[model samples]
Target: MAKRRKMNYASPSTNKIPVIFSIAVILIGLLVVMSSLKKFTHTPDQGAIEENVQMKNEEFINRLVPVAKELHQAHGILPSIIIGQAILESDWGSSELSAKYNNLFGIKSFSPNDDSIKLKTKEFKDGKWIEINANFKVYASWEDCMRDHTLLFVNGVDWDPYLYQGVLLASDYKTAANALQAAGYATDPDYASKIISVIEKNELYQYDK
Candidate 1:
């Protein structure tokens, strides 16, 4: 008897297996797509967040702008420096310096012979920084400090950053920041950037330049 020839025809059972595998692959692909979409999806609570920020900024301006204007009018100086100094040193007028001293510029006592009342400061005496109970100019009011600032700048004090009274004062904020940095007016790590930031953000330069 001749050996039976092996049949090469695929049975219905073979077709069923591929169909089941294809269905599983399609389902897996769908699941993968869904998971990828889920990971990147974001629900935006749009207007509410922006509105709160705007409101807070408005409130800050409402409370603080008068002080800036008063400082500006009292002395022919641009209020941006005062406002920037106040905002930076005072952390938007919340620091102890702002509350009690109201000396926004961190003005140090330059002269012992001078009669301006002073604050005890830490100064390097021999090798280490020592706390010296010495005089630092005290202001009866913010207006007084503002006046002193004006005088200090008018005299072209070494640390007068803007040197506003100079004949060839900087025409813009960047120039002022650079001139100030070169003049040793500020020891801030980001003095130029900070001043420029405040000037630009608040549009405070409009008052003078």
Candidate 2:
């Protein structure tokens, strides 16, 4: 009976091998796609982070420019120095002391009756740094804080009314920065240099005009 056609049927296991191979290939492709997506969605690069920081700094400077100019016109405090100190002391008004209490200049309050808050701060002393708790002035707004800061230079300490007169007399940022350091506005020995660097780097002198 015409020799029964030799039948060669594939085994279930053999069929499963191709299916498994296809599934594995598909899984590999999916893995590759997921990896690519992860890379695409990764966090911002260092350059992006720096750009963001620069933008924020610019915003801080811009926000202070008008007020600083006004104060400069009225008080003779150089806008460059005012803006630079704010940048350095307040960290562009991002510091907890400045942001929360509007104490942009780190102005301390010596009297118990003053509107103030006690906070820990670092002071440069004996050629080193020390942490100390101090009372810092509190203000109702940034503008008010700025006005108070100007007033400090204008009014000076009770013991020395002309302590910061050198700053007001300064014709340039460098002189004003040095005057601030000479007047002991900050305990940091490098305070003047730091302020000058900030002013120059940001072209804060332009605001002085």
Which residue runs does candidate 2 get wrong by more than 4 Å? 1-30, 39-42
CA deviation > 4 Å runs, candidate 1: 1-76, 113-135, 158-168
lDDT of 2 at 93: 90
Clashing pairs in 1: 117-136, 117-137, 118-135, 118-136, 118-137, 119-136
Give the candidate number with the greatest lDDT: 2
Error of 1 at 87 (Å): 1.3
lDDT of 1: 0.63
lDDT of 2 at 164: 98
Q: Per-residue lDDT for 76-181 in model 2, tens only?
A: 9999998899889999899999999998899999988889999999999999999999999998988888888999999999999999999998999999999999
Reference-based lDDT, each prediction = 0.63, 0.93
